[model samples]
Target: MSVTESKAKTSVKTSKKNVKPAEAAALKEALEAAQIELVPLSALIKSPLNVRTIPYPVESVRELAESIETIGLIQNLVVHTLPEGMSGVAAGGRRLAALQLLLTENRIDAGYQVIVKRVSDELAVVASMVENNQRVAMHPAEQIAGFRKLSEQGKSPAQIGDQLGYGSRHVQRMLKLAHLAPEILELLANNTLDVEQCQALSLESDQARQVQVYEQVKAAYSTVSAHLIKRVITETEISVTHPRFVFIGRETYEAAGGVVREDLFSQEENDGTADRVLVDRLVMEKLETAALAIELNEDWSWSIGRENPLQNYGEDRENYLLLPVPEPQYTPDEQQRLDELYATQAATETYEDEAAIQVLIDEIESQAAHRQWTDEQKASCGVVACLHNGELCILRGIQKKVKTPGEADAATQATSRDLHVIDRKEPDAAEGISLPLLKKCLPNAHWLFRLPWYNSHRKQWP
Candidate 1:
């Protein structure tokens, strides 16, 4: 109107030029590859996807939101619509979490526009599994168990490979451990063995030989890894069963900390005892200090510590380091891997998969080139995940930068309604023993042989 009071003309202004063409093209390609389309969060209110499948680290999303506060949601998730309308999260739960943070801060509109990719139904599921396997960092036990469940549910290695975007060999390796003998499995369950170690055991043609090696290695119980054991087995051409003894000597001092009482125990002491002295399981908790709890299979394994040889050593309990049966110390060698993958936690459902993942990664990265791969590479050029439910439960491919199958828009969406909490209760004691757990409604039950947790390194000392 000011252009000319009499002419009524308007001026057309243009934005500055000279933008980065490559950056623009890259952004467009990324958005397209990720299958991003504009949509609203209300549409994703009740996604059918279980977050378990798409696990990630909370820290990652927090970092992303921090970036978003300065920048913006650079990309979006891929989703599909139900019969009614555009709805549900398909893949990219982590991405959604990042965007939500911005909305919560009022930095973005409550119902702002969001871009998403329309992933296929099959891709949706595959993406979810990838998120968990790689990002969530699936536990060794869970990986084996999940594969077994899939197989039991009529899925084969090839099928699992196809669904989870794993190579047939990769799936086969995991399946190999899943089919180990019960003894081998028992060691794994008890944190005495790992998957590669189990895989190494599988190489033995003779089942008896495998068991012998297992027992011997377990007996020696050093931190030597499964791969090292494999090398030794192949190089030495020796029987897998190599006997290792538990040799621990404690020096008792009489005044001035001088050595007085010294005893060396043989392997036989692991399970046998000289006499029957009732052990009242007690939690010797020191104020301001770490509480002491004795668990046979936990710290001082009863299999090696129930000898009761040290009980009658002295009347002054203060001057003596009173130990329950075994002293709960692993030989320096095997102690290194006591916290390895598949190692069960004392009071948690979580499992560590670091070593197991390391093993699997070594196998996957050494493959041939120029092959048509079924899986696509990961989003951030590799993996990005979170710790959920107290553990890294996801098992996705980071090195391969690969994406799994079974992806599509999630039809249902869910937010964490509540956090998981471990219920702590005092052990019910009976007959000087507090039952760690009551079986068959027996509130008072004491177990045999105990190893105190104070010296928890190896904690399986004999």
Candidate 2:
């Protein structure tokens, strides 16, 4: 037998033994006296005695209408007779509004009959209060389970939302939560994990990963935040905004079979990629290709690519001389165009326009500042192409050979002596000068010691 049938039979058997004859008779009478009638849609009106005086949200009314359209009304409106052949809905004000909405939309005619339980004026207020107050909302876990069941039944999220009066995105989120680790779901059911924490955990598709993060969070802090959970979950993954990821761009990375997962709970445009190794490989390959192109096109001796050459080379970077490239002289037409751009930039009132104009000016100047090495420099030097702030950075005319020990030693000794002399004079100078100001002046004092007047008076110092 069906569970409902079995339960019904059990209820009948229990009532037969427990219910008194007089009590049964009274219930039968009460059911008969309660007047249920089919009232026309045009005759229904909101009663002033309704306990819900606050206006229903527009979305609530719309959702109610959608529910009614899907399965028709499930509950009868409790209403009372009015003075002019109309009925005032004392209990179901929102229901009456939803019916009116349907009528206004031409989905239902004004003459359509509505099921209403007619109540006396004296009992109307009580009925309205009872209907509004005497209800329990379903738990979130139960709602999620129901949504999952519907999804298993081949119902799309949009279809389920239309039938149940929920937004599609809300249904989608609940569906995602339903797929979380069993342990996490149990915690959610028991009120240990909240909706937000569950949402964060759902970002990881693997149940093992979700459980691992949850246990780590539980061990670390007494109170776990959604942000903390997400951070822990995505710590090993590369962020979409990472320099290499941004340089590659989303479309290209996806085309290369790199998967990106978007963080729905994040306030900003945050996303993560699982393929960190692939991204690094692609970045290096692209950088090397760019370096090769620059070497061939510019007639340089050689070129190499490094992610961050400065950090990689460390103190050795000092041995290479970075040749300064002068900006090219603008032609007459180029000069006139630049003058017009400057005037437009000055006249622009909005910050956005000013920023755009500045970008244009910078681009033009960058093109003009292209490095042109002499034939001798090209044969002896090479270029280093590296990444800086998600963009390609080219260090041109970097000396290929290291400096001689004699030259390096002489430079270091001069620097050390200059610093030592400044340190010695600082104590006496501190008596009259602010320490910060004196410290700032000391770095520039190396040039001061080379002055003829200062050298002539050097013997006067203590």
Number of the predicted model whose lDDT against the real structure is largest = 2
* Candidate 2 accuracy as TM-score: 0.56
Q: What digit string (tens of lDDT, one per residue) describes model 1 on residues 163-202? A: 5555555566567666667676666655466555666676
lDDT of 2 by residue, 1-462 (tens): 000111122211100122234534543464358877899899889875554544566898999999998999998888888988988897788888898999999999999889988766645644554355343233455556656766776778776555454556666767887888888877776667777778789889899989999889889988777789988887767888788888878877888888887665454644555578878877887788887887888788888877874432335444544554443456677668767876776676675875576566655554454443577878786777778667777666666434577787676444333221111110121122223332344666767667753553354333
TM-score of 1: 0.29
- For model 2, give the 10-residue run with minimal summed lDDT: 420-429
Looking at candidate 1, the ten consecutive residues that score lowest on lDDT are: 275-284
Give me the displacement of residue 268 in model 1, in angstroms. 31
As a whole number from 0 to 100, the lDDT of residue 228 in candidate 1 is 56
Model 2 whole-model lDDT (C-alpha atoms): 0.65
